[model samples]
Target: MNKFYTAQEVADKLKIKKTTVYELIKRGELSSSKIGKQLRVSEDQLSLYLNGAAKNSVSAQHHDYQPESSLLKRDYLLHSSGLIISGQASPALDLLLNQLPSTPGNLPVLQSHMNTYNGLYSLYFEKVHIACAAAAPEDVRSLVPGLSLTALLFCQYPMGFYVKKGNPRNIHDFPDLTRADIIFANREKGSSRRVLLDRTLKSSGISPESISGYRNELVSDYSTAAAVAGGQADVALGESYAVRSFPELTFLPLTQETLYLIMHSENLDTPGFQAVTETISSENFRRTLALQTGYDTTHTGEIFSI
Candidate 1:
């Protein structure tokens, strides 16, 4: 049987600090399981992370990656001009992709799970055709620097703090997070949610360091919500619709953000883009998304400039 090690145990074995171990787990780099509200890394998981650490280093992923060059392209994307979207997995997008012509290959056809910065990065290099982002107006505009971007209003949903049932911490506002009682679950950097949280924190004049567990990150809305639900965290940011299925969590609405499907203006005239637009505009698509995801899809298919 694989032995489960505490965060401190894992940290000692790797010759790193306990906080660093939590940071690794927060980044989703080190696999761990929650043991009655405490995180533990199995022996096998630690070995797997150590094995992949060399090839998937931070330097290579964050700084050295070159998506524009032919040498470093994602082979699964197929066809230089093919439609590849980057964002959280969506069944609606899947159905739309199924309508497109398939490139016969052994590789699986899938959307890259990169959102915000990384998604826009892929788009900037033409590695991806579309990117889904939810953020403030100004921040969204800064995604693509040189390229003129055309955005299609996708969905509007409530973005807020996810707290445990009854919100025992009574985390009603941003200032409440500063209290020593609340253990926050933050989203990873570069994610649109994290960007929103950071900008909000700045504007609200709430120092991130003041919040307990503010540095304890989780990779996705669901994961963050799950942490709160599992009692691993006191508060986490997420979309109202995304965390709806996570039981034992109360979503305190802070603001609503419109998610947009953004792409380069140069590809606006392409047949692939045209099909994508058409699919989004269909009554069924808009209605289905609203009903299933609880997103405001009234303007889902409308085009706009960012």
Candidate 2:
């Protein structure tokens, strides 16, 4: 007799949200049955899926990733899992991916994450070879903690608030969040924007609970910025380049944030790693990157030990 488990049970056993369980089923990654409009998974099917996933998992903590692995691991150099690059998907990054040499036959691919925090965490766990983040090295090291990774300077961009045109609410700084009339749409927890918000709120001695819409979370910069553009939100934290797509919204510069390519210190000298440095440091890369609004290429390919 096969025991059938509800979506919630599968989510619990897998340590994921219930919505994700149903999504997996929808994607045919996980098998399920509809017991009169209720989704159910059999133990055998779930077991099979877990076993297969573990064998393919780069790190169980991050999922839905392509099978490719790091730049050049000594153990699997021949059957190497290609280099995995993690970060928010951006034009510059996509260009970097295209410029990368077809190492082991064009195996490099970007493992898109929500933002810098997710990318940095993936770097810390050795899940990705090179990770990008819109976070300064010191900020990532001190405030977020965990990684002993090296930082490769990618570019610099302004970090700021996304507000409606003409700054209707007179929303100028982080303190504006404390105003009773302000409605905030926030980035997901752990994103650099979210990190900055939390850090600033704490330093200002303002209790998070005191702010209205403080708990309201938006999934990505695009979404959060869109909320402000559509008048659904009063303000959102974002890096300047990202909010450029929403022309209707106005960006109020707060500070500058540097984009960094993070990696394990031990992998610095690898040939594949060198290829990455070459691609980013090249004149063509910088020239095109500088063309993008709000990007500073002064230190585009510089590396630093973090």
**Predicted structure 2, TM vs. truth:** 0.72
Q: Which candidate ranks first by TM-score, i.e. highest?
A: 2
TM-score of each: 0.71, 0.72
The lowest-lDDT stretch of 10 consecutive residues in candidate 1 is 101-110
Instruction: Kindly list the per-residue Cα lDDT of model 1 for residues 28-70, writing each as its tens digit.
Output: 4565544443556777667766865764576577777544454
lDDT (CA) per prediction: 0.71, 0.71
- Tens digits of per-residue lDDT for model 2, 1-306: 567898899999989999998667543355454343345677766775686577567555666454343421122122223565666556677667766754332443424343676556555555456778877667668633655667788888888999988898999988888899999998777677888889998899988887778888876678888888888889988877767788788889999877788887777777777778878888888988888654889999998888
Q: Candidate 1 at 234: error in angstroms?
A: 0.6
Model 1 scores a TM of: 0.71
Q: What is the lDDT of residue 4 in candidate 1?
A: 83
